[model samples]
Target: MADGEPPKPPPRLEESVKQSQLSPQILYSDVVKAHSQPYSQQPFELNTIFDAESSALKEISTYQGKPSVVFPFSDKQVLVEKLKYVLVGKFSHGRPPMDTIKKFFVSLKLKGDCNSTIFDKKHIFIECVCKEDYYHIWLKLKWFIDGYAMRVFKWSPDFSPMKESSIAPVWIRVECLPLYLFDEMSLLSISNSIGRPISVDPRNINRTMLHSSRICVELDVDKPLLDAILISFKDEVSKNILEKFWVKVFYDEVPLFCSFCCHIGHGTGTCKRRLEDIRSGQGKAEILSADKVFDNMPQAENSTNSTKFVAGNCGSKMGKQIRPSMEWQPIGKHVPNARSDLDNKVAPE
Candidate 1:
């Protein structure tokens, strides 16, 4: 029966067309009339949409003039207290992935779990599960991740991404110290005069090295570093008399410290504070003395003498005159009138 007849249309398509034809149509004139009506007489649907948009715009305008809410000090204190075991670290060369950092710390066999997250896009914020883990990670000072050096710093409530830490733990060697003053208490006393003493080096504790005692101390870069310390002690031969000794202090691998700005990471030549002072006619830039400049230069090795020469500061290739080494007095020798004139020595301009 279907062979000679035409096929019928699909039921859904035919029904859809019938339904469309049955629906009422709005003329172009009717649409124009509706839009031409006053806002009060507009259709409910159109009024509702416009009213919602207007309300949103008004809310945004009101917010534009409102002041930002100030963060309470109590809340900040609570937050910082909770993050006591947190540390902030940043690579000097490259920014490694979070997993790479986590795995690297884990490989060290830390006492507790350490979690790391990207901080300020350039730095890494690490949270340790325990205080032991926190000190273990932080006390190392510097870490190498795939040969890239990462500098770790303690996290504080006032930590800023724009500024580098001014306080750093540095290993300082106290040379010319008497052999009798090699104990922990004596070393700590000497170290305290320099900065906040963290710990005495293992070799110093064991008395393996007698030439100098090494100690890790937390130094504030904003303060002037003491190049030498003056110690007064009772004479071994004459207990009633006091004698003075100068202990030479040597800072190892210290970054560029600005004497003008009293900050680390920059030299006096590039000090912004000095530039501002000069520009404002408040004061002239302070030139570092020869002694201060030489303090920063590496000591040249020599068999005859420990002498330092300034080459470029005088615009001469031959270099300045060699500085003579200080004459160190023997510890046991008693000279009742022996006095320390080392403090009176002045550097030539």
Candidate 2:
């Protein structure tokens, strides 16, 4: 049985499972290969995008049956450096100052440093800045743009894929892009000027886009009007006529009585001027005033005192006069003010 020959060991699993560089997988394969190799060793070129002068983008795009998503970028050297940093590394320090970025670039101007936008995201209908010659830069940064798109929106950027903006997530549309993107010059001038320049990538929406165009992004919002609509939408009995009621008839800058009574007519019985008017025969008042003239006011009846004081129930002493209030009973059944009047009448002066 010819068993003398030594059998070769099984091939290394490392070689068997080794990944590939290209099968026309487009940006995905590029990232797979780039990440497969150490980030420290992968070209790390910040200047020119990979294969800027080749039709490789078209071939790879066709191989995957996807179109190239164009991204517009600014000519500002600051954006170029920032974009370079994003391409070569992650966005550290979050949002840094444009001046600081520009200052850095001005200090260390790199050779052939072309400005590229981080549209790292694209959707169906192929979002882009409607800027002049945007297509030029778009074709240049095709790989990075598509890679960013995959990393951001969680799906490949597709023009006329399946759904339109009318079908996208509400938070993705209203809050994210137009509202946030309109404010960032990085997106406004470089990315498309749609309602929300801020966009979720078709591939991965987590990776944020650093640059966009302001021309198409309509970020302006009528906040007051929008709030009004929301308020109306949240309409309830709270906004009803009786009182713009909060928890228990809450009051504002206006006086408590005035606010409750709509600030126009008479207030609570605590009104002092109304009491005087009732005494002067201007109107027949129902609620008796604390300062009313009492028949039991023999004490201060002829006395030359404009008013005398009488202690009330809760330390809130009321003004004493010839007239007595019938509406409010004293703390005790007996009238304390009456007793005071009796004592005052008996005393001289």
Candidate 3:
């Protein structure tokens, strides 16, 4: 109020708020004091409390719980059995229209009616009405439709759309196998060295053809397939001498093989592992050259007119000469002397 005296400073916001409520320390002390003043109470019966809880749980379980519906085991088995006759097909490079695939099958003039359905927009689920058609479609393993390779797989109970089939039935021609080994047992044993033998060509069973034996084998696509096998047999001229014969194997309609990962369904160019290595600044993974992997196998010549020599005289002498250019033709091309029994069964009508 005096002229020389400064006006009293306004109360601070914090001081104003503090004046309205008790301090935190006082509040905490009061809470502790309250909790420390324990009062006596009558003891409760444990059995009564447990009984009440049990009654509540029973009511909730009986009234609020939902009943689970389980699928019948017999029905599941029947469904799986029906699925056994189904085959799934996927194009290796691209997915063609469903109508185009259906038309292609019709052109083949399949033995029985096959109901084709699109599976996951990427595969074709083929349900064959008759068992004959099912085997016919599945046995071929790969079909060329419009120059695209259509890989067929048998539908199993554990079939998944996200995963690719790593096992396929591949028809392999075992060349350079001596005429003596054309018998069923010998052919089976040789094919077993490559994969699990499924069936031998009908011609091989009758010994009608001696040049090469064809056998269908279930090959694991994840493993590196053998291009040739070495068979050690006692020399016919000398009982004490053992000779090694390298039998060359040729696979028909095998899917893309990856040398980087040594797996099928993908090639080294598209290998995920190689891409990861490159992305991480590690450069490309060391890919094993085909020559290094199959050291003893016969290598194809670079010349257009190169000829493959047959095994003879302990793999020293060439018994027959095969034109390498014509031997491994691209898919969908008809060879001059291709077998008509199975390979060319699905001719366009």
How many backbone clashes does every candidate have? Answer: 0, 41, 0
Per-residue lDDT of candidate 3, residues 90-145 (tens digit): 76578777778889889879777888998765688999888778778878777988
Candidate 1 lDDT, 78-97, residue by residue in tens = 87888988888977678767
Off by over 4 Å in 1: 1-85, 92-94, 129-136, 139-142, 146-149, 232-245, 257-349
What does candidate 2's lDDT look like per residue over 290-349, in tens digits? Answer: 224321222211233332222211132222211332121221123211223222222111
- TM for candidate 1 is 0.50
lDDT of 3: 0.64
Question: For candidate 3, what is the TM-score?
Answer: 0.45
Model 3, residue pairs in steric clash: none
Give the better candidate number (2 or 3) by lDDT. Answer: 3
lDDT of 1: 0.65
Error of 2 at 63 (Å): 63
